[model samples]
Each structure stands twice: as structure tokens, then as C-alpha cells.
Target: MKFSPHAWAKLIYLRDRGTTEVGGFGITDPGQPRFVKDIVLVSQSCTEITVAFDDTAVADFFDDQIDAGRHPEQFARIWIHTHPGRSAEPSGVDHETFARVFGNCDWAVMFILARNGATYAELKRTGNPHSEPLSVGIDFRDEFAGSNQAVWEGEYLRCVQAAPMPPIWDLDLLPGDEPYLSEQWPWLPI
Candidate 1:
């Protein structure tokens, strides 16, 4: 697995879940090399022992991404979470979750990041239900990381000039709507 230096940085340095595990989407190439482009962090409500994703929200996000023309290979193909200790091995729950959630992918990957930045990774291709998860290599090139820094800084600058989105949920309301409920709002509610 290859990753933009920024993604690696986020995985290694940001453990927002305190002493527990934290996870996020690993957006990568849908083909060979599978270089990760970004890390979209998922919010967690856990402490120093366990963790889980908001599966519905995560799945919905993937659905939206797919609808938006991003290919399935980029659909959070890798499941990444940090371990509080030095061992990056997957626990029982990790193995179970990987099978349940990522089993349908053409190929699935897992990255278990240790607290001290050590890493362990594995990959399982679909249709090999009984096969052992195979080990994969992680490459964090310094040049790529440097490019990531530049891209991130550029994005931050762009956001400065962009308009912030309005806040509203569970309603047919949209950003430009003035007469909020005129004509029944058109779209079905989630």
C-alpha cells in the first residue's frame, strides 16, 4: 500500500480517541499500487479499550462517494484503526468486522497502526473465503509526503474564500431555499 505522506502523518500522529482506537476512511487508487490519497477521519465515541464505526453513516458516505463518480476502489478499501500498544496485530473483533464489512470488495486491506507509529497490514481478496489474510507492504515516500503538505496548504487557502454551508438536517430544506416548505420539498426523507 502506498499513501500520500499526509495520510500517513494523520494515521501516525493523530489519535483523537485519546488512549483508545480511532479510525477513518482510506481513500486510495481503485487499482494497483493502491496509493492512498487521503484520510477522512470518522468520529468515535470511545475510550481506552474499544471502538466501532457509525456503520450506517460510513456506508452512506461511501454510497455518496460512489454516486459522485469516485470508483469503488476508492471507496474506503482499507480499514484503519490504531492500537494503544506496540502490537499492530488485529484482535478478534477486528478480524470479524473486516470480514463482515469489507468482504464484498474486489480486495480488502487493513492497517493496524500501533501507538508508537509501528504498522502492520494485511490484504484479503474476495472469493478466497477460507484463505489467510496476506501481508502487504506500506510505502511512505518522503517526496510524496512533501507533495501532500503542499496540497494541504493549497486546500486550506482555497477554503478561506469559500462560503460555509448552512446547517439543517432531517428536512427537505436546502441552502438556497427561502420558502422552506413550498411544494412539499421534493425529495424523500432519510
Candidate 2:
């Protein structure tokens, strides 16, 4: 799939903005649904390993896009997200979320961009057990808008809340230590 220069730059900026993962929706060209012309980010809580969009924010985004006269194909089919690590491979969590959330759509794309510039994109269609892998690239031929850091930064700050995931292990405790495990996980009776 192709991204407009403007969208590509914005994605790169968003990916490098912080340590946590970030996600957004790609706005496609009306006549060319596979060509992402822009991007719109929704409010979300993000950690190093995950990004969860706010349901209300997502609904509002749909409303706003509808009000703007854009169809769902133009705004909702492409799920764009970043990987804070080097690998662009989707995790188990990503697979679960993609199937649970976007599986109902006629067609959808899950796109991941890693910090090392590695990318992974897969297109899923209803009734198809196998997904198609797509090549990602920047399309510079289009007359794209320039990046507005002020606007992008504002959107990033307003939409993304960096909620760090707690470490699974306490450095002071060994694997056999029960006390630390019990303290760390109060819900579990260790």
C-alpha cells in the first residue's frame, strides 16, 4: 500500500515521538481506497507493548468523519500502528485485537511500523481464512500537504496518554521469591 508523503512523514514523526506505541486510522483517497492520503488519531492509552483506543473517541471520530462527508472506506478500513521495538511483526495481542475488532468489516488492513523502519501490513477479508501481505511504500508523486508539527503535536498530546506497563518482575527479587510475586500481584494468592 502507498502512503502520501505527508502521511508518511507524520507517521514517522508519531512513531518517534515517544517510547510507547501509538495508533491511528488512515484516511484513504476517495477514489483510491488503498492509497492513504492522510491519517487521523483517536484518543488512546498507550504502553510500551500496547495501545488501546478510547471507544468514545472512536465513535466521535466516526461522527466527525461522517459529518465531513467521508465514508467508512475512506476513514476506517486501515488500522495504522507503531511498534516501539525493532520488529514489526504483530504480537499475539495484535492478532487477537485485529480479529476481534476488524474481522466484521468487509476488508481491513492492519499496518505496523517499527522504530527501525521495518513494516508489516496484512489485508483481511471476510470469509477468507488467509490474509494477504502487502508491501508498504511512500508515494511522492501526489501533491501532498506539508507536515504541521504544531497540529500534529497538539493531536498527539490530546489523544495519546502514555500509560507505562508495570514490569512483570521486580529486579530485587529472584524467580523463586514468593513474597515479591504476592506483593506485585495482590489479586493472586501466591
Candidate 1 segments exceeding 4 Å error: 30-33, 130-190
lDDT of 1 by residue, 57-105 (tens): 5677777788878877786677777766555666555677787888887
Candidate 2 accuracy as TM-score? 0.87
> All candidates' lDDT scores?
0.59, 0.85
lDDT of 2 by residue, 1-190 (tens): 9999989899998999999889999999689988998889999999866789999999999999999999999999999999877777776677878889899999999999989899999999999999999999999986768789888899999999998674654222222234423544444344
How does each model score on TM-score? 0.65, 0.87
Consecutive 10-residue window with the lowest summed lDDT within model 1: 170-179
